[model samples]
Target chain A: MTDGLWVYLAASPLLWLAGTLVVWIAASSVAKFRPGNPFLNPIMLTIAAIAGILCATGIDYGTYFEGAQFIHFLLGPATVALGIPLYEKLSLVKSNLVPMLSALVVGCLAAVGSTVFLSELFGFAPAIVASLAPKSTTAAVAMAISSGLKGDPALTAAVVVFTGICGAVVVTPMMNAMRIKDFSARRTCVPWDWHRACLLRGSRRRIVFRNSYGTECNSNISCCTSVSVSQLDSEHLHVDAERRQAHKRDQGAGCRLSQWKSEPGKHRARTRLDAINGQQPRRRPYRRGPVD
Target chain B: MLNGLAILFTFQLAGEIVAYLLGGWVPGPVVGMAMIAVALTLTRSTSFLNPAHEGTVSTSKTILANLGILFVPAGVGIIQHLDLIRDRGFALLAVVVLSTVATLTLTVWTFILVKRLSGGYGND
Candidate 1:
């Protein structure tokens, strides 16, 4: 054979992913022994390990993405799952929806505008400037913008990662220094830009996820067409009103929605779970706490 | 832990279907998230108050526990692009900082203004 099967089976991306998994196991193992090691983070360790493997094997980037993309697919489901916590925090979102939305819009505009402006000022290339425009958003969305803006997707990914890491490292301290005790800065960004769960988790763990932008409040990452959960009781019908409205609306769906005290327009979800699978509706409760 | 993770997964898959039917203009993940929020909103408890199942990690917890893992790929991207950053590092740094600050400012402003105009999420 031409070793095609071996090459295909030995795809570089597989090595990268396998490397990633191995690094995680190793770091976690180290953590078990020495929980306080600073340089032992799986993040740093994994990257180094993979880079070393790719170097030793002479695997190019294109080959690595093939298998690595398998893990990338999880991004869709992971992002979607972030809403559960956001919904649980719907009240908090509602209590501060205006501030949140204001922050998101202004933040988006400012982030994009300033980068474009300053990059041009600094005499960066148009492609570089364009790529930088959407760096404030998450990676997937930013990648889309990069392609559209003719900027380097890889470069944009770099900016986004740096942005996230810096935000995580700095925001809390900055807030503390500024005495901005409002603590939660609700940013009504687009849906699908679901990065709020981390901040929520940080808040719950009292670890403070820094520089958080609650863009998911606006729509599906910022794509929320329905009202937030906290606003349900007040903006939603009172029990009697909801009960009556349910009767007036669908009579059936409304009744079901009302059973759980939900607002109609927002939660119009159709869970196409396999009815024939004999699987019961999930009843497990989360211990890590919902929505952080 | 695993059980909770499974619930979270179920929530996501189911939420995807629900969001699509609603004509979501955004990506599927956001819809799934909103769907999860809706489900939790309807339920009597949360991941915090009620433990999903012992020895079975909930989806909610799994995401959090694996949070750092999720970000590792991005970090790796950082390593790959170190050369680019070093070359035009100043401009890139400005972009990252300014964009982040700007987004944060706009988001907060809009949220507060909307709250004022909409009578605080238009509730009561």
Candidate 2:
């Protein structure tokens, strides 16, 4: 009777789908209390738990994917959804266009060139090296690029996730150790890089930034502003502290442009920062008139 | 929500067509992203009054907030490459780590250099 039940459940499409969701929820719940703990990453946990269960139960990845593909299909839509945040950051992007584009050119070349060069130095096969080439971008885009290059999309996706995790773990210490003082300089790559999500979550726990370059935006975190500074010098930290206080005062309405105007305290912070710079705050894309 | 989803899907479909016409040089979703971004920028003046715009932004936020989960299915594809992973896991890890470091350092350095040359502090 139990054996029959096992076979029946395994055959149902809902089984692994439900299983993946449950495992993910549990992993997220466990990781919730310890903010910034990369080791307890819910995605990593869910993938590991499900992969382990499948292995022990003798279910092949193909079988498991049949049910899980429903979730996977959302990646395409999520990619489209990235436009909203990209739109939101248009003003900032405009102001930083030169720096942004220059960084993109240098970053893309460094990301792909370094990966390919190092992979070859490590004696990886051409296909495998190609798979690793686009690991710095979003998993979906990287997978597509990998396929175009005649590499394995699966390998590319896996490497992308791995590279993201590694980037997340290393970025904070590496940046801090180098004493990167400018908040904007540190996140210049955020608009073009998804690897910073881990850095975002690990370091800036308050506001989640949604800016990216040419890939689907990761939305596992908050989506208000990507400009949250992490461990910056005292001056920027003071501005951030004021912003945080303003956010709290507004009952967590966040730093949305709409909210930024209504919250006098946030407005005051921005005005003060602008005064210090001896210039006016850059015009917001959504603002209707001159500063009040 | 449904209206917003429709808009997103429409853009994605358009993106697919664009990508196909371009011989897949760019991914469909990315092309779709650029299209929506352009649309949003074009409509920014009236975005405050457009309910559909609000709906799209909120809908996209909700989806992106759970983006990590969407990656699971593909990340699990590592199962298929277990042999390669097993054979060169350390080498692969080293390469990823080193390359990532190199990329981040170079990108940040370049941005700072350019920003300074442009006479801005990157304060914003």
Best by TM-score: 2
Estimate candidate 1's alpha-carbon lDDT, on a 0 to 1 scale.
0.49
lDDT tens digits by residue: candidate 2, A1-292: 9999999989887998898889888987776667566666677788888878887888988888888999988887787777765665566667776766677678777878888899999999999988898887777667767888899887887777777777767776777777776666666544333433452353223133322222322111111112211211112222234554664566433344345546555665555445333343444455443211
Model 1 CA lDDT for position A163 = 67
User: What fraction of the correct interface contacts does each predicted structure contain?
Assistant: 0.56, 0.79
lDDT of 1 by residue, A1-292 (tens): 7588768766656666776667767765554454323234444555567666665777665566665666655555555445544554566666665556555545555666777788888888787777777666666555544665677776675565566645544444443443332324331432222332223222112122221212233211233233233221222112223433543464344235445544332233111011111122222243221121
lDDT of 1 at B76: 52
Candidate 2: lDDT over CA atoms? 0.67
Candidate 1, DockQ score (0 to 1): 0.27
Q: Model 1 TM-score?
A: 0.59
Q: How accurate locally, in lDDT, is each candidate?
A: 0.49, 0.67
lDDT of 1 by residue, B44-88 (tens): 553543322332224543554454455445445544666776897
